[model samples]
Target: MTPSARDVSGKPQGVRGFSGALWHVATRAPAELFSALEELPPLVVQVLHNRGHAGVECIREFFNEPVLPHDPFLMRDMDKAVSRISQAVRDGERVCIYGDYDVDGISATAMLIETAILLGIDVCSYIPDRVDEGYGLNTEAVEKIVKDGVTLIITADCGTTADEEVALAADAGIDVIVTDHHHADAVPSRATAVLNPNSPDSDYPFTGLSGVGVAYKFVQALAEEYPEKLPYPETFLDLVALGTIADVVPLRDENRGFVIDGLEVLRQGHRAGLRAIGAVAQRPIETVTSSDIGFGIAPRLNAAGRIAHAQLALDLLREESASQAEQQANELDALNTERRQLTEDAVSVARQEVGDDPVVVSVSEKFAPGVVGLAASRLSEEFGVPAFVGTLIDGVVRGSARSPEGFHLAQFLGRHAELFETWGGHARAAGFTLQPVNLPKLRAALVEESRALEGDVFLGPQLHADGRVFPGTISFETFQYLDQLAPWGEGHDQPRLVVENVCVQTARLVGANHLLLTFREVAADIRAIWFQSGQHQADMNPGVRVDVAFRLDLNVYRGETRLQMVVDDVRPSAGERSLKE
Candidate 1:
């Protein structure tokens, strides 16, 4: 799907950028280390530290310039889950793999199916209908699985909260193994083994594994037990990377390894689905990155779930033939276009209905069930408030929600559980359902709860200087230092450089949403684009003196590669102390 640009806060140029630095400051990075690192160039060290690679060995291990994988058993439930799945395969019992409707769920499902198939188990895969089945396991879906001759079920990204559905499956004599990464309210019953990092009993080395990461651990454990039965499990890193990046999981620890190595596999273009998606999205397949997956690929995969059956995304990933993969890619792309239009219309309606309150709670009887979450998220971004965008499906009102910082959306929604038929999620995102008539109360309850919180709960955006770099500091040689710190996202992110006293030689709107600028500081000349900031051109005049946060990039045009800075934000220097100092 073609990506639509949205206005985001300033992009930072140094130390994993502002968010990364904020995490460090919040976590208490040593002053000496922060100061010393700042001198080295804020952007590079920030990214390095954000990835938990603070020194030489850490950096080497991070890039996998040297290879490493900590004990597989460190992952929660690795050994026990593996043993059970292996025993199930040996018993020749039919197994069904169920997953959620997003990119994480789809990739995890595909990973499980492929791994099981290699182990001589043709596990049946089930993805609940986004519009019809809602999120997670349902009693009807489980009963259907039981009737389909399945005895064991491996659930990816879901089933952690389906205590009742799992119990129902157990009553029918089916064993369930849940491999999910979603945060759960309490221990669930009926699963033979529940492998979730967030579970209280889990000692998983990382709590931030995406659904695909959890699925990969299951395969990793399987490979440990029967090395000869299946190929090394690392072959699926491409899928892991796609789902990991798409889901916006923290890119630290094992997650960093998964994405770092997975990006290389994706660059190899082994998956026809990724290749076809790159073609349809007009991205170069050979140079894919986390950004490409997040911005370019995931949306199209998600579009399938939002507008139609999520099975289409799973099918594209699981296609055995190149031709079939291409066909599915095209179909998903077309659906995504329609999905975008639907989301745009839904958001437009949501905006009109939402008032100028600190929180936004809106309901649209006409909103598409599939795209409500996207609409909610978009609305949250637009208004800088928590949002719940709901639609009536059948007799119940089902919806998705997006929350801002300090909102704890899932917990807040959970507090009002009496009003909901069912609900699930984490701090930033959540889902719920209720009788249609109950929405007004639900909306009022949420808004009232939101208003009770202190104002200014969110720390307004700020710029973190990586260190000062004169225009002269920018060169192909200097850029090599920047290039080593790559494969950035989620827990870690691209570096942001704070360049001060830059003269805005020129500025103008370019393309649909980007602001093109000609900038220079003493000894440096640069070209930059403030994407989605074109509307600010009126305020940012040529010859203006400003401090800017940006990333250095290369734009190849007419076969000539030239250096460019991707400006994230610009501020008048008179406001305060020099941010770049």
Candidate 2:
């Protein structure tokens, strides 16, 4: 019984677990470059080349060498930012760290507060409530902080576009130093110093730093200027890494350095809260990798902000006592569980509401403001189109937007600026608030804009297979060589290989929704598993010939380890026949 390639709606199903994507092998690397990399396997070299690391030096730097941090002062207004922060520390003035309500913002807030405390500066932190205060600086929150006698406000992961809030702070005799990474039309004049790599006037070499990355640079400059006031800058890399990975920044250049070194710091478990969280997640803190941070640690940290006050997460990062850290970790884990359920419900509803329109917009009063972004992200990936999920309360609507590749979310939102009360974000993701009165106009505008895009703009998702490989070639040695590309994420992905013309010797459903199978090719027989792919079980009968896209993995059971293939996609062999029934 070969599986059907179409869904119940008679639409072609995506390969493997992808909702609606086509699977294809990536182009082979240039023969010259492939031959020059004598030390690496052809497949590995092709993967690197396909990802744009074609030159010899580029490959070496990406895999072997660490990217040295650029001069911190190269950022626009870096000098002014450093000088004002120094004066605040020297004069014993009240300082406040203003942040957003996400993992990036929480981590940045925690990092700066920790750095300031080490310097014996009078400092406090504030993260606006996602539902009440919205994003960035709000007038009420700013007034309250100023009224608390805060003389200086240093923003972390936010305030790039807070022109009015910065002006209000100035009117109250408070200075602001903005450290953000979001795209901005122009530097806000009211801020005493703005440290954004994306600013039009910025000459910073790397523009992909996360909000916490920017904060790390500020602390880097601080440590250089006043060595005695701050600890070695490397001590804070763990926080920088968490934010960097969670924010999905490109893992190249300076960002690569941050994650590589930061993972080392994180493995040391110097932060008690992180250690406790790792324990709850069943991940060994001493051997935590980038995937651990992305899947285990970050979700719990972000849960606090989504379901409750972000201060809980900030507290977890700053907690010093082992018992206290354990308590905080448990609370966050519970919140994360709740958040996951809410997100699942929202996605289910959003999927049903999706029409034939190129853009998906789901509005519901039941939607939680904090979880809308998660719902939007799921919709975008599942439908292969831009998505906007909003929660309507009273007459105001707060929404999060996610875009597929080839679309710039920030620019799209900019064109609709007249409809938003507040809006800003990067190329792929953004958030905004608007009145219900503009809903009709916003929908019409998006439809027209989506129609204006190229006809093939949303032609499903694409799965890039590094190259075809024989089942017999998947040995432990090959896996070890590929493991050198550690800390894989957004820009740097785990290698996916195509194993062509293999016969399924046995197939079964396991763990509810997982498809477990044994694939045989020539003299080799290998086990494979496809998670959440039980729906395809009918197609994967014994003796069926198929080509599978998979990632090489090691499975351990009964204290024994063996190689296995984690299936990404599966299709009937193009031109192959099985010898056995």
lDDT, model 1, position 562? 77
**Candidate 1 structure, TM-score to reference:** 0.85
Per-residue CA lDDT of model 2 for 368-429, tens digit only, reads: 87799999998887776788899986678999999888778899889989999888998889
State the lDDT of candidate 1 residue by residue for 124-191, as single tens digits.
98999887778889988988998999988999998888888888998999988888988877756767
Candidate 2: where is the Cα deviation over 4 Å? 1-19, 522-526, 555-562, 575-581
RMSD of 1: 6.1
**Residue 273 displacement in candidate 2 (angstroms):** 0.6
Give the Cα lDDT of each candidate: 0.76, 0.84
At residue 462, candidate 1 shows an lDDT of 37
Candidate 2 positional error at 328, Å: 1.4
